[model samples]
Target: MPRYARSERQALADLFQTLGPDAPTLNDGWTTRDLAAHLVLRERRPDAAGGIALPPLRGYAERVRLRIAARPWPSLVDQVRRPPAWSPVSNPLTDELANTMEFFVHHEDVRRGRPDWLPRDLPAGLHRALWKRATALARVMLRRFPADVLIQAPEYGELSAGRGGEPVRVVGPPGELALFLTGRQRAARVQVDGPALLADRLRAARLGI
Candidate 1:
């Protein structure tokens, strides 16, 4: 997971650089300025009882980039050595994991928005780890849907389909599946194997971030 986070962060930073002026387009209607502001807001606002001020976006990204380039090995080690501070928003583990997932998912988001901004490359191990983590997170998110919908992914085999009867089929690669469930990827990534109407309804229900 530590390695995965490191790789994911690197991918995100690379995407940011590649996207350049088009970075904000990644979040559907949001502009690059909006995306930058969103990240800055997330970083500055503490989820815990007491908030710790985060550096500005420009400074934050510079720090992260320098940390990655100069001492990537030590950065991963440091993350393991130091626990993430608590946030008032959610569980630290969940939040941290989500942040990592956000990097990968948003990378796709930006790439999809700007076809010219392709990823240079992705580590094989990082992709596999993301697949595992995304599958687990998808299962958790699927639980909120009605019982009749059967959400299955060949990549992860049969997952807990929640309740029965209201069948809504969702299938795709782990990253696409995660983005689809999170309402970021609206494409036909999730196949409604059962009833299309149910899938439509599920799609209409906006899942919170």
Candidate 2:
């Protein structure tokens, strides 16, 4: 697949400028400036990036992110627009693997944060790539879920996960399915097939990215 990360990076930079630094984002309590600063720190600061997942470092991570956010908004967003050459995560070699979903999800985070936003008309190749990644991620994120989950992505393939309970089938485009599985169920436009209560529970259940 073509490098989607670069395009998304540029798109988010543009959006940040368009909406202004005070714009809201789907990430609770984070403004556009906050999101931009987090992106900058993720690629540039190795010591704090682990806070995204590891609870032990979360405090440090937030402190570092806040410190970056305290800088001038234009400079921070520009840093997000242009990743440093030495950035381990944003450089050409790792950008595709590490930043595609990162940027895409965050792009949607900013998009869906506002009212009347619609899904992007993504390329087939990008959808398939997202499907491949979501499938692998589902194996892990859904492993402990209460119900047995089936993810159906049209023109791609399907992934069956979750521990054991009732079987709930999730039907959507690959990108939507990825969003649903990654803690964005409230925003993901997908059809859930199976019992009504089970479906509600599935959508409400905690999902890790």
Candidate 3:
């Protein structure tokens, strides 16, 4: 099987290096440098990683992130490309589970941020992998949403999500769907079918893992 995580890691690192520190990313307030710094801290700083999940710890995490972001851009990108082996999320055993989607999403965040961007043709297996995770993530992020969310990736599979209401079918390939539901609705390419008002509302609603 192809190693999606590492490929995405390298791809994102290369893009960050190519774009330089000031380039815009789909991440609302982040630039290429900010994104690279986050990736480095995510794997290298265990103590601060929890801040990503816990509201109170966010202050500490931001402090560390800012400190890291101030480093030379090349160094930050290198750290993202080659995480130390001892890091909890970088070792082979946990890498796929920890970083596959993490890197994939962030990679697209940079890719789609550019005006001339085009979606890449992802591998079939990787599409399946992304769709499987997207299903699980949808259950979490859209659990309270006001519509019955149907995620459709034509060649892969389909699944339902959200609290039931007017059924909303979100159509796209797996990778795009993953991006859409993961708080990148603006950057993702997808078709929403349902009541127009409800569909519009759905698009405006919060999504992502």
Candidate 4:
């Protein structure tokens, strides 16, 4: 099997180096430097990683992350590219399960953040991997959505999400579906087929990890 996590990590790091520290990313207020620092903290600093998902720990996490972000750009990108063997999420046992979608999404966060960017031709294996995760993630993130949601990646598979109601069908490639489910709805090139108002609402909704 291909090590998508490793490949995506390296690609993202190279993009960081090419774009420099100040380049914009799909992460609203975060720059490329900020994203690199976040990746470093996520892998190396278990203590601060909690802040990424937990509200109460966020302040301290943000402090540490900001400090890390201030390091030299090349150093930050290097840290992102080479995960330490001792790190919790990036170690041999966990790296694939943990970072595949994480790195893929963040890679696109930078790639599609630019106006002139175009989608890449992803490998079929990676597409299948992404579809598996994207389905699981969609179920979680869309659990509260007011309508029944059916997500489809024609070459892979499909699944239903959201609270019970009128059905909404979302169709796209697995990678684009991943982006759509992860709150980058505007950036994802997916098709939503449902009630006009509901489809529009789905696009505008805050959906993510």
Candidate 5:
């Protein structure tokens, strides 16, 4: 079974619990409260504001707490099924999968500075799924980066630029590779071996995140 939903939720909840009083910074200067609000709003009003909605920052923390308390396990699957109530926004499976991947990745984001926040265990199945999603997203994002570079991580097989500089090698288990590419975790289980310069460039870009 695809355990992305449950595992992702567990990870996020654990991260929140671990973070406690200190608010961690997320992408684009958003605080932990902002990140939590964004995640909750996205799940609640997926269609708000062209698939993007911004709630008031003042009460966001409490809102997030309440929202998290109210949500049930099957909410994500239901959200995936229906059209986002917000117009001009669509939730493709790719987007849904990507969101699931983001949840897992961002869990690490909040925990990065706090050592005690690290997850004790990550579900193997969910990790594999995220890796696959990361591979696909990496291919899409590679166009923005140099083609000469290659990423070799055991979690995500060997990804290399193909002819005309398109990413052609997206071979690997989805979860591990996805986490490595995104910078959530180091490529410990896997190794990137090819074009040192390219590898450095890829690392700099942080495509997996």
Candidate 6:
């Protein structure tokens, strides 16, 4: 199988080097340097990574991330480029399952963050991979949404999410659907169909892991 996790990791690292430290990303206030630090911290310091999803641990995680972010730019990007072989998340055995959606999303974060951005022509195989990941992600991220949610990647697959209510259908390619479900709704080019108010709410909802 193709190693998308490894490829995306390397591509993101190259993009960081090309854009330099100050470039923006779709991740709210995070710049390229900040994103690089987050990646490095996630892979290198698993102890601090938990704070990403737990409010109680976030302060410590942020502190550690800031320190990592403060490293010289080349050093920080290098860390992002080369994850530790023994890290639980990025080791060869687990890297694909863990980092495919991660690096893909963050790669688009930086790509779509720019004013002159255009979508890439992704390979069909990668599209299949992303569709698989996106379906699983939508199941988790949209589980508690107010309306019944149907996510479709026309050429790949579809899946349902949300609790239950009036039905809403989101139609787009897998990668864009992934972006929408991950809180980049404004930046993702996808179609939403349902009651106006409910659909609008779905778009505005805070999403992602």
Q: Which window of 10 residues has the lowest lDDT sum in candidate 1?
A: 47-56
Off by over 4 Å in 6: none
Which candidate number has the best lDDT? Answer: 4
Query: Per model, how many backbone clashes are there?
Result: 15, 0, 2, 0, 14, 0
lDDT of 1: 0.52
TM-score of each: 0.62, 0.96, 0.96, 0.98, 0.58, 0.98
lDDT of 4 by residue, 1-209 (tens): 79999999999999999999999999999999988999999998999999999999999999999999989888999999999999989999999989899999999999988999999999999999899889889989999999999999997998998997999999999999999999999999999999999899999998884
Residues 1-209, model 6: lDDT tens digits: 79988899899999999999999999989999989999988999989999988999999999999999999999998889989999999998999989988999999999999999999888888888889888888889888898899898887988889998999999998889879988999999999999999999999998986
Pairs with backbone N, CA or C atoms under 3 Å apart (clashes), candidate 3: 181-208, 182-208
lDDT for every model? 0.52, 0.88, 0.89, 0.93, 0.51, 0.92
- The predicted structure with the larger TM-score, 2 or 5, is 2
RMSD for all candidates, in order, please: 8.6, 1.2, 1.1, 0.8, 7.5, 0.8
Global CA lDDT computed for model 5: 0.51
Ranking 1 against 2 by TM-score, winner: 2
Backbone clashes (count) for model 4: 0
Model 4, position 89, has a per-residue lDDT of: 93
- In Å, residue 40's CA in model 6 sits off its true spot by 0.6
Ranking of models by lDDT: 4, 6, 3, 2, 1, 5
Better of 3 and 5 by lDDT: 3
Question: What's the CA error at residue 6 for candidate 4, in Å?
Answer: 0.5
What TM-score does candidate 3 get on C-alpha atoms? 0.96
